[model samples]
Target: MKTRTITGVFFIIVMLASLLTGHYSFGAFYLLLGLFCQFEFYGLIKKSGYQPNYVAGLINGALIYIAFAYTANTHIVQPVLFLIPVTLSAVFIQELFKKSTTPFQNIAFTILGLMFTVMPFTFFHAMAYVNGDFNFHLPLGFFVMLWSNDTGAYLTGRAFGRTKLFERHSPKKTVEGFFGGLLIAALAGYILSIYYTEIEWKQWISMAILISCFGTLGDLVESMFKRSINVKDSGGILPGHGGLLDRFDGLLIAAPIVYSYLYFMAT
Candidate 1:
């Protein structure tokens, strides 16, 4: 309990500070996060009887993140998208020399790593520039809703959880907890609207619901992968919180949805 509490507090502090500091801090933080997730993901895949071109995958992931970050920062859509295929092509070329039996699977996982890990992080970075300027409100509000949903679910699950939400993938989550999370996340959205009035309460509430539903699914998806790989946690970087992927699984699924919501709102 003590370890979890301490890690959670420090994690929150670093996250908030990064978001609040400026674009540089935010970009660096998520860039490193995406790289770590790719590393851990390839590690797991390798453990499951496959070689996933870890070096090539990491390089590709890093380039994808940099392309998005650069565009978000400079407000210019450069031809950096070309760099992705260029980097990914290296994986296929390198695979031919490795003599691995599952070369095609190796290439597939390498590309999938970018989609699974780096793309969502790119969406997350875009939240900071929702209005063509870097204001802390949109991203900050997004995270506030996420945290509220997580807290509400945990508390409600412990208090009144009976029926399983997804018994096969995640046995501990309950239907009651899902609704409880939505309710509290909606409240948090309303609170965010009070201060960060750029987006209205209705939209914020809608986003909260989306976050809750998809975030829980994201957690279950990660569990499914870990179960398939015969592992407990993704990694032990967080002491009690598992790996970066374990902690940000919710963000992985929720960020793209929230990004789409914000983009449509802007359009």
Candidate 2:
């Protein structure tokens, strides 16, 4: 327990520092994290007895992060978005080099892993790229909101949880705790909204609810994968939390969705 808490704090500090200083440092930090997560994902898939192209998976994950970073800094849409199909074609062509039992299956797994693990990180870039007039606190707001929802749900669920949120995927989650998480997130949103006059009340509430709901779903999704793999945690890199992937799964899911909402619904 002590180890987990300490490691979690260290990870949070790293994240806060990187996010607070948005530019090349932030982009590089996120890129590194994406690489770590992609490596872990590739390792997990390999354990399933199929030989996914590890290099291809890393390249794909890096491409996704590149798209995200470029989009955040300016109007430049990453050409990698268009290059995915071309890249996949190359992966297919390379499969002929190896006489594997199931080459197509391996390639499919690699693509699915990219979608599951790398795709959602686009939200981080989107959050970094809010309108120029906004203050430095814009990105911090995202971290606070997400952390509040997670903390609120965990504490609330432990204290007064009864009904399960998703028993099969996440047995420990309770519907009561889920609402508690939402309520706390909404309260945090309302307070933060006052600072950012550009965002309306509805938008704040929407962000809060989306984080609580989808963030919980993200947790469940990871749990499902872990359960299928018959593992308690994704990796042992972190003491209490599990791994980098475990810690960031909710953020990965929530960030992109919230960013999308803010982008499309803006006046």
Candidate 3:
């Protein structure tokens, strides 16, 4: 218990500090984080008897993130964006020389790792610069609401959960807990609107709704992935949190959807 609590607190501090420090730190931190998550993902895939091209995946993942971050910061697309497809194509070519029977499966998993782990971080990092400038409010608010939802769901489920939300993927989650999380996330969003006046309260609440719904879906999706492979945790990088991917699974699915929301709202 002590270890979990201490690790959770330390994790929160590092995440908040990275965002609050500056754009450069924020970019660097999440860039590394995204890579780590991708690495963990590839590790899990390997355990399931599949081989994802770690080198190509990580290299292209870095390139994709850096390209997005650069575009987000400068509001100008760079030539490096063109290098992604070119580099990614090399994965398929590289697999041709390998003796693996599941070459296409390897290729697919490699691409899936990029889409699942890398692209979301790219969208999330872009969130800080969504408004033609670097402002941490939206991204910060996102974490706040996401954490709120997770806490609310857990507490409410433990106290009064009677019905399962998704028995196949997650047995512990409850319908009642889902509503509990929605309420808490909405409140968090409302509170964020009070301080971060860049977006109105309704918009914040709507974002909270999106987070609650999609974040839960993301958790279930990750759970399904683990169940498919018959594993318990993604990794043990954190003492209590299991892995970086385990901690950020919600962000993986929610970030892109929320980014689209913020992007459309801004435009």
Best by lDDT: 3
Off by over 4 Å in 1: none
Score residue 66 of candidate 3 by CA lDDT: 96
Cα lDDT tens digits, model 1, 1-267, are 899899999999999998999989998998988888988888889888988888888888888888888887778986987877777789989988998889899898888888888889989998888778788788888889888999999999999999899999888899999999889999999888888877778988988988999988888998998999889999989988888888888888889988898888743
* Best of the candidates, TM-score: 3
Which regions of candidate 2 deviate over 4 angstroms?
78-82, 132-136
Clashes of 2: 1
- Model 2 TM-score? 0.91
Worst 10 residues of 2 by lDDT: 130-139
For candidate 2, lDDT tens digit of each residue in 30-120? 7787778777877787877878888877787887678766766766676767876776676677789989999998888778777777766
For residues 1-267, write the lDDT of model 3, one tens digit per residue.
999999999999999999999999999999999999999999999999999999999999999999989989999988999998899999999998999999999999999999999999999999888777899999999999999999999999999899999999999999999999999999999999999988789999999999999999999999999999999999999997799889999999999999999899744
**What TM-score, computed on C-alpha atoms, does each candidate reach?**
0.97, 0.91, 0.99
TM-score ranking from best to worst?
3, 1, 2
Better of 1 and 3 by lDDT: 3
Q: Tell me the whole-model lDDT of each prediction, alpha carbons only.
A: 0.87, 0.77, 0.94
